[model samples]
Target: MSAFVVAYFPHLCLAFGGLLVLCLSMARSVPAGFYPVTAGLFAALPGLWAVAGPQGGSPIACFYAGLLSVIALATIGLLARYAKRRGFAGDALYGLLLWSALGMLLLADADDWIMLAVGLELASLCLYALIAARLDDNLGTEAALKYFLPGAMALAVLLFGMALIYAASGSLEIAASLAAPGPLTAAGLALVLIGVGFKLSLAPVHLWTPDVYQGAPAPVAAFLSSGSKAAAAAALLHVCSEVSPEAKELLWPALAVAAGLTMAVGNLGAVAQGSVKRLLAYSSIAQMGYILMAAMAVNDGGGEAALFYLAAFALMDLAAFGAVGALSAEIGDRDDIAAYRGLGYVHPWRAGVLAIGLASLAGLPPTAGFVGKFLVFGAALSAGYVGLAAFGIITAVVGVFYALRLLAALYMRESLIAHPAAVYATGPAATLALGVMAAGLVGLGLFPQTLLGTIAALFGGA
Candidate 1:
């Protein structure tokens, strides 16, 4: 029992943290910052243990669990001011966030179909409620509804795929099921891919992302794009690792085509977006395309590259959306691209952080995003997916334009909002969180080996 508790302390910690935060909400004298700070501190414990503690799990699983914890911490940091200002700063919101982190941690370590389903649903169900945190807003309600219905259908499809796998393999193990090849296995894997693809916002099934993101609160959008995507991507990479050679031959081509389409659609869609959140939503989709390309190369050094990119993406995305949340007026989010005009001067620190995030997402050098892209492309080329790599490079170039467009609005354009002064001011919480993320992006870019060396060591020099 002690061994079991030690192995699973991180999971137990999160469950306890959620309840603790819920109970703390009952106190009348607790400071407004107490909840987010307390939540962040509790969330950080798992990450700290995963990073500095003994490793009993695979390096990949440890890395992902730690990554999810950091994501939770950073999100709570940014959520501090945004939550207080938006009137949603309470135990219920923090409880949902902590519980969802528990789910993401589970998904990151899952090795079977049942575990994956449970983790995915646990994470996803909380996200649906979080999106509608602003209960009074019709847009929030609609966004939650849109996400929930599609998500439900995807879960059904995924469950059916799992059922088919059980029929073929007569076991619940992911490894056994993937290694057991037949027509049923093939169809089952295909369905599973479709279901996961929808969650990751890969194209053809990614129609919900933009509207949902635009309508959701900026902090909530950050959680959805970063925490949810990271867990799903990590889970998909684990699944890819378990595939047999024959199954790979069949699955690889289909995944490659999907990557290409997702890259094309996401970059193209982002180019025309006037809403900042919508643009980031499309960019988030495109980022997944690149990550998917790396996932295909898992046998040939893709695991390390995928890990690096997911970490960098979570930082870049949370920083970007956190800045947006910081700059939002009490009335609503300053979501319009034009609403940002002259705010660079009005709020230099927040705007600068936003710029760093955008530049990194555009694959600018001296940033983690640049190294992540280079590593991803290198992994794809080395793995013999040259066409996908080349196409990813091209789509990446197109992605740059939208980032530049947003930056131009920030720095070049004149004030467009009727009262730019009415925009919310940045507090210590957002500043500290965004600053850490921005610093990490540049630090990793300049010293790519900080992460690269870790990945190499973890995989025995993969």
Candidate 2:
């Protein structure tokens, strides 16, 4: 029991913290500033655990859990600020964020099918509520419905796949399922991949991402793009790590095709979007495609590359969305890319942060995103997926054109209409958040050796 507690302490802290916050939210006449303080404390708990908690799993599991904890805390801090600015009251939202973070932690440490499925459902349900928390917005409600329907279908498919695997292997352990080979097992793996593919927004099944991101609140969209997507990618890595050589022959080719198509479709789709939020949504799809190349590699080096890239993507993407949220509050039109015309002249700090984010997203030099892409492509090439690596490079170049469009609007174009009365207003909290993330992105890009060495150790142990 002590060992178990040591291994799973991060999950326990988040779960207990969530329940405590939920209880506090039910009390009447709470103090004015209690929730934010409590939120800071809750966020701190995970970071502390990441440093001090006992590590008992495989090196990959430990690395993923630590990374997930850090990302979750960063996301929660950003969401708390966004929620406060939006006049969202009560501790309920914070509690749900903690709950979702706990679910993600569970997924990171999951060693068996049951735990993975449980974590997936828990995180999905909490996100459904979070997306629709703004009940007054019809678009929010509609996006929630759209997200829920597909999520529910994916959950069902995942459960069915697990059941089939159990029947074939007579065991529910992930490694055991992989070791026991049969036609049923292969079919089950295919079904499971399909389900996870939807969550990760792989092409063909990625139809829901843009509409949902465009409709949901910007902070919620940020969480979906960063923390939630990272968790799903970790789960994919966990399952794929156990694949047999024969299974790899089939799975690798399928993943390669999916990665190629996802990159192509995502970049092409982003080129046509008029909404900043929608464009970022499409950009995330392409980012996921790059990460999937690492997944396709399915080795220690690949896992390291995937983990590093996910961390980089989370910071840069969150910074981008944070800038968007701040500007949306001022402009009142979250969807219009045109609203950002001449923003660089008017709001240099915010524009600079957004530019850094977009540059990183485009894989420009001296940014973590560029390092991540290099590692991911290297992993693919080393794993003998040279064709996929070449295709990913081509699509990444295509992505730059769309990312630059937003920058062009920010710096080059003149505003077609008069500015709103609130156009100059800025949220200090959001700005601070973006500044922190932007700094982190630059720091990682310039000094990546520390992180790379840490990842190398973890992968070596795995």
TM-score of each: 0.96, 0.95
- Predictions: Cα RMSD each: 1.7, 2.0
Candidate 2 regions exceeding 4 Å error are 418-429
lDDT of 2 by residue, 70-122 (tens): 55555555666566667765478778877887787667667888998888878
**C-alpha positional error of residue 331 in candidate 2 after TM-score superposition, expressed in Å:** 0.9
Give the clashing pairs for model 1: none
User: Candidate 2's error at 46, in angstroms?
Assistant: 2.2
Taken over the whole model, the C-alpha lDDT of each candidate is 0.86, 0.80
- lDDT (tens digit, per residue) of candidate 1 on 153-174: 9999999988998899998889
User: lDDT of model 2 at residue 39?
Assistant: 59
